[model samples]
Target: MAKKDKSEKKKKSAKLKDAEREARLEISGDLGTAITQASRSLRTVQTRLLTRSGLYSGQEGVVLLLAAEEGLTPGLLAQRLGVKAPTMTRTIGRMEAQGFVERRGSDADGRQTKVYLTETGRATVDRISSANKALERQATQGLSGKEIKVLMKLLAVVEDNLHAQMPAELPEPIDESEDLAAE
Candidate 1:
């Protein structure tokens, strides 16, 4: 029993070492890692600015879209934004609670509800726009116009490559209960 216990300890140590090495290998020189880090930092900065205007990170996108086109059904908005229906529904619900948006039953189809910006929501457009412009200026502080254009093109290529390789639908979330025992 002692020998078996020793062997199990060795196995666990080896697994831990392997996991550490794998993590180091991936982050050191990976483009995806760099992109993820940049995105996270940008989001943090944007969130700070947006919070000052009584908006969350993703909420600005919804406000901008509705500002551009009013009376969009939730389903249509979800499709345009490339988010799931339930996600859009929750966002609209929260925005409605905040008095930023209103949903009215469509005259053509009573079952379908169309979303529109409330007067308060319309007033928020300028603040959102200013926040976005500030973010852009901060992000591009050291880059030249030509360099910025090139960077955009390269990022677009990377995005296109990843999109092409992406799965048609994401898989269900993994169950980590078995792994928790080891932890």
Candidate 2:
């Protein structure tokens, strides 16, 4: 009975070691390790800045996108951000409450809502953008110019691959008629 107990203990110990080995192997690969590490590091920086600035991640991106686009619908903002409509709607609502954005009924289509950044939102985006640039420079201290370029290209490829794998509808080219009509 003692021998049998020892044998079972040995098997259990071996299985535990094997599990640990597999976990290590899974994260040892370059793609997995780099992605995990980069996400962790980026989140740390983002959270720090966000905490200090009293902003949320998705909300800040929305502000910057709105700053550039001037007047975009929540549908268009969701498409640009690659998020779902409900998610963008909630974020925009929060921003609206914070006095960062305002929504108005579109003259072209009263049923459709158009989002515009308030002066407060534009100013916040500008401030956050400058802070983000400084934080990014500090984050990429050791990388060379070529390394930075390659890193961006590789990340873009990874993003494209992930989006290519998704089953969602892709964006279409803008209609010239729509642009002229808007003008």
Alpha-carbon lDDT, every model: 0.89, 0.83
Report the error of model 1 at residue 29, Å. Answer: 2.1
Write down the TM-score for model 2. 0.70
- Candidate 2's error at 34, in angstroms? 2.8
Please state every model's RMSD to the true fold in angstroms. 14.7, 16.3
Residue-wise lDDT of candidate 1 within 1-183, one digit each (tens)?
999999999999979978975786677667777788778978999999988878877888889999999999989999888899999999999999998999999999899899999998998899988988898899877589999999999999998888788787998886889789879
Candidate 1, residue 92: Cα displacement in angstroms equals: 0.6
For residue 112, model 2's alpha carbon misses the true position, in angstroms, by 0.6
Return the TM-score for candidate 1, rounded to 2 decimals: 0.74
TM-score of each: 0.74, 0.70
